[model samples]
Target: MTANATLSPADAVQGQLEAYNAQDLDAFCAFYADDAELGAYGGETHTRGLAAIRERHAKLFADFPQNHARLLHRAVVGAHVVDHEHVTRAPGGEVFEVCAIYSFAGGKIARVDFVK
Candidate 1:
């Protein structure tokens, strides 16, 4: 795992966003579960498992080299973390807000579902 100044899940995800803004896919993907699933918002694309997720992110990173995600709000219930976030596509200066529900296990995200 990559070490950072983050202490909570929110902080960890924020750190991930920092890595993404830097176009460091390695550090960004490290925040997810080994068998993690990423469901695309309002789309039929769903990437399951680490390898698939990596592939999906690879394309995303290539498409938007300066993407940065920020958490606008969060609600935590036990190990379940829900975050409302705004992701900025720096190249286009466009922002999109999405809500994501994450299930954490052993301090790692085991699942993620994005809701528009």
Candidate 2:
């Protein structure tokens, strides 16, 4: 747990998702805690900590400007949010649906597990 937490866990995740849709790396990263962890689908944790997360996502955003994630559904239980999303990168690129489970602590996202 951390201090000065102002946004609700769900709200933080929502903001981050919104920022993600806009491809705004800075805004997207703002909702993560300093020591946040992201676990990739069918893989180990690809990134840990805010700086690493930012760099990872920044490269994604820059590499694929047409990348977009559409929130199909969401469920919130306590400090956890599970989001069903449809993601696409460009017209000819891979398009897939994924479920992302987010764990929030101190009003920010502390962990994320992506299921594809």
Candidate 3:
């Protein structure tokens, strides 16, 4: 079995969140499936694969080295995990709230929809 096959949905989501806060691209991407999709909650798709996801986050981390996300709430239902987070791009910088819905397949995140 693949490493992801033994990873729980909640574990995958939390792992990615920690990796994101630490700005570890490889570790962050490890939680997602190769063909995972990322998009706005009900709008256009922002990313369509692990490579694209990595590329997008690479720029984000570079631009906001101090970026951090605080988890306000999390819920797991079946293969999906929902998270409400407060994010700051920098100390005393742009702040926003986001709700992320993570869909898992084969124990890895297959898609993520974001409501900002």
Q: Using Cα atoms with residue i matched to residue i, what is each candidate's TM-score against the true structure?
A: 0.77, 0.89, 0.95
Q: Please write out the lDDT profile of model 1 over residues 1-116, one tens digit for every residue.
A: 36243446665666566676677878877877788777755555487887887787889889887777787898888777788988987756888998988776656666778987
Candidates in order have lDDT scores of: 0.74, 0.86, 0.91
Clashing pairs in 1: none
Who wins the lDDT comparison? 3
Model 3 residue 7 lDDT score? 78
lDDT of 3 by residue, 36-105 (tens): 9999999898899999999999999999999999999999998999999999999989999999999988
Among these predictions, the greatest TM-score belongs to: 3
Alpha-carbon deviation at 63 in model 2, angstroms = 0.8
TM-score between model 2 and native: 0.89
Worst 10 residues of 1 by lDDT: 1-10
Name the candidate, 1 or 2, with the larger TM-score value. Answer: 2
lDDT: the better of candidates 1 and 3: 3
Local accuracy of candidate 2 as per-residue lDDT tens digits, 16-68: 88888888887888788899999986689988999999999989999889998
- The full ranking of all candidates by lDDT, starting with the best, is 3, 2, 1
